[model samples]
Each structure stands twice: as structure tokens, then as C-alpha cells.
Target: MKKDIFIPKVENVYIAVVNEYNEIYNSQDWNAYIINNKDVDLEMVLIVTSGYNEGKITSTFRKKLERLPAKNYAKIELMQEELFALNNTFKVSFFEGNTMYDKTFLFRKNTINLKALQPIPLMDVKGVLVK
Candidate 1:
């Protein structure tokens, strides 16, 4: 029989993806801040923390560092109304030209700008696989 890993789940957690220089690239639904480009092309660290107690929970993404040494990551910033976007789902595609990304890039929300936006940029994509 396999033993289960006793990982505790917490609410209101904060996640930030930083480079080796500690520049904030990506973050969770909240707390997204602008990052300096000088911190790019360094090791990427994904930090997951507990919200209620304010403690670190898990760290992942070292594998990505070994693969793409000079790659940059960006965190999505959520505005006051943009907080709703965290719960939404969207699709991605590789279509190009005037008909660029027609079918598979539909966003879930019905807001004006949100309705016609693609979450992830498709151009110059190296890898699209989720860990």
C-alpha cells in the first residue's frame, strides 16, 4: 500500500514566481507587482505559502531552471475588478495572421476587454506543457 503525503491545504495563500535575483515575475490571484527586467534569465522559483498562518508550504520549478537558463517569466496582475478573473477559465491556440487564434482562444468572462483577451501569449512559445 502507498502512503499518502500529509500536505496540509490552506486558504488565502500567496504564490510568487521569482528569478534568481528575486524579481517578482508571476504571482497568484493577488499581490502581483511590477518586476525589473534585469532579474530575467535567472533561476525561477515558485513559492507557495499559507495565508491564514503565513508560512511557506511548497516550492517547485527547479526543473525549469535547468532547462531554460535564460528564459523570463511574468506574473499576472489583478486589478480590483480583475480579481474575478482568477476563477475564470480560458483556452490557448497557435493560430496566426488576421485570423489569429480564432477558435481555441476563448475567454470565459463576458466583460468587454476580458471577453476578447487571451490569457497566455502564443508567439515565440518554447514549451506549453503544464507541470
Candidate 2:
């Protein structure tokens, strides 16, 4: 008897949102305004849910980011330099407050310790964590 092999589709481009706490967010929440635009043409936008700041998510700029597409849609851009340079384990920092935000992140042995980001920053929102 012969068996068939299964292959998974490759995701060429990925829109990574620099969210906090590794939570999942729906793009529609912030991108609804641009959905009806006539000049938006982006595949996906990862809403990196940066931890909240003053009751709002930090750097939650899906509106601006989604408007970058030609069809008036924007997508999260991921550079090879950043992704490729990252090891199996690494830390990412994200800001939480205003006026020169500061925070710390560390990854080791393919594991991320969430506690390090207690007092997050205002920028540098890293993408969601995937195991």
C-alpha cells in the first residue's frame, strides 16, 4: 500500500503586531474605518496588542498602519534583519506610559519570562509570542 503525504501551506508574508502579554487581537477593531476605502490592498495586519497605557493599548496604531496599503490599507511590516537575527529564544521590550517610555525584556532557551515587562514602555512593542 502507498500512503500520501500532507504538506502545509507556506505563509510568505506576515503582519506582526507588537502586542503586550501575547494576547490575540482582531484587526477589525481598529481597521473598520479603512475597510470601505477604495484603495486598500493588504493581506493581513497583526495587531500587536501593546499593553494598555492610561486605559488604552500602547502604540495601538492599527489605524495608521492599515492606511499604508495602496487600497488605503496598511499592514504590519516585518524586516528580515529583525526576524532573522532573532534566536530561538530572545526578549522583547514594549513601552506602556507616555513621555520617554522605558521597559525590559529577556528570552532564554526558547522561553520568555512575562514578568520582566511589568512596567512596560511606550514603544518597542514586540510581536506576539509563538511556540
Candidate 3:
């Protein structure tokens, strides 16, 4: 019975960390975003994020969205520079049509930096993408 379960693969959905100048604060800030590159919309989207290291752990953050349109993206949270030293993780769950999909994206310790940035899908700026 365990082998009879059919789990669909999640495709084109990603979590990205972007560093951009904050016009209001007049400083650069690191922000997390959820990208939906699929042709269909995602409903009841949920994301839980946290950072951890050998002996340090950050607070868990939970965010939810009613819907995420296709080929679009939405900002999830602001990431403090201090969190960069630890391994950051994002747990995503959402519904496509009548099926549910889940995926985990992670950024290893000390990896969220400008040097690791690359062009992100559906976004004009470059940023680090979680694999």
C-alpha cells in the first residue's frame, strides 16, 4: 500500500534570497521570495522558514498566501544579515488544482551572499536560489 501512493513532483517553484536597496530605509536588505513559474495558480500557499547552525537557531517564521498566480512571485520575509551565517530553510506547501504539493528549499551556511547570486526566474534582479 505504501508503494501505491502517487506523489507529484514540484516543478518551477522556488525560493530565492535577494539583496536590494530599500528605498524607505536607504539601505540594502536581504529579502526572501517565492516564485511560481508554473502555468497554473497555487492556492492556500504556506511557507515556514528558519535558520540554524551547530549551536544557534533562529525563530521560526510562518507565512501564508491565499493565492499565487502563475508566472509570478511574492515576497515572503526580510532576512537579517546575521542569519546568513546559519543554514536557512524554507518549507513550502500548496495546492495545485485538487492536489497538494510540498517541497523544501535550503541555503547552506554562509552561502547567501552577493557572490552566489544569479538571475532569478520571473524576476529582473539577480539573487541566490535555494536548491
Candidate 4:
């Protein structure tokens, strides 16, 4: 057997939106998910950054991922409509084993455009406990 070998990469992590009722959100109650498709478990910090030169849009939640198991996901309670007005990106710092990884993924501009976004699935939905 191949043992399902997979090389863990921090860049593979991505964001998604899931509604509170496990259904399509009605302009609110949408959550932001960080899906991890790696071979190792990770703990991470997620911060949303946006806005103009002077006034910056900072995430008050300061979402944290205590444990993102291999091939699993965790999410934060972030509304989709709230981020559509500004350009948003996620600055993620995660630790896998003894090594640290950092990267940023564009959300609002490329992915989360409420004005033009339609239903699309990027990855499989696998749930994990998130702190």
C-alpha cells in the first residue's frame, strides 16, 4: 500500500464560507473556514487585513486555529457581506510539527466578491474542532 502519502504545504490552506444553519446564508451568519489539506496537523493564527492607506480594516475576532488536523478544516464566525466592501486577505501563520509556516491568501477581491460570486466548491468539507 502507498499509505496515502501526502506532503503538507501551508500554501494549500484555503478559505470558504458556510452558513450558520448549514444552508445558504441570507446576507448574514456566514462563517469563514480555513481548510487544511496537508499530511500534518497544524495550529495557526488568522488575521484579515484590508482598507486604504490610513484606515485599515482589522479583524476584531483575531481568529485562531488550535488544531487543524490533516485533511480537515476549521472556521471563524465572519460574515460574508461585511467583507465585500473592502479588499480582504488572510495573513496566516501556522505551525506544523516543529516548523513554522506563513502565507497570505486573497479573499475579498478574488474569491469573496459578493457582487459576482456564485456557488462553487473548491474542496471537500471535512470538519474539525477549532479554538
**Per-candidate TM-score against the hidden true structure:** 0.19, 0.17, 0.96, 0.61
Model 4 off-target regions past 4 Å? 1-9, 19-28, 44-60, 110-131
The list of candidate 2 runs beyond 4 A from truth reads: 12-110, 114-124
Query: What is the C-alpha lDDT profile of model 1 across 1-131, one tens digit per residue?
Result: 24674423221111221112224754322222112122223233232211111232222111111211222344433323342332222222211222222111112232323233323222222211111
lDDT of model 4 at residue 92? 74
Report the CA-based lDDT of candidate 2 relative to the real structure: 0.26
lDDT of predicted model 3 = 0.95
User: Model-by-model lDDT, in order?
Assistant: 0.25, 0.26, 0.95, 0.57
Among all windows of 10 consecutive residues in model 1, the one with the lowest summed lDDT is 59-68
Q: Candidate 3 clashing pairs?
A: none
**Most TM-score-accurate candidate:** 3
> Which has the greatest lDDT?
3
Superposed by TM-score, candidate 4 places the C-alpha of residue 80 at a distance from the truth, in angstroms, of: 4.7
Tens digit of per-residue lDDT, candidate 4, span 12-128: 666665544444544435566776766777876555544322355654456776788888766656665556556555567788777777766665433444343344233443222
Instruction: For residues 1-131, write the lDDT of model 3, one tens digit per residue.
Output: 98999988899999999999999989999999999999999999999999999999999999999999999999999999999999999999999999999998999989999899999999999999974
* Pick by lDDT: 2 or 4, better one: 4
- Residues 1-34, model 2: lDDT tens digits: 2357433321211222232331364332211111
Candidate 3 ranges with C-alpha deviation above 4 Å: none
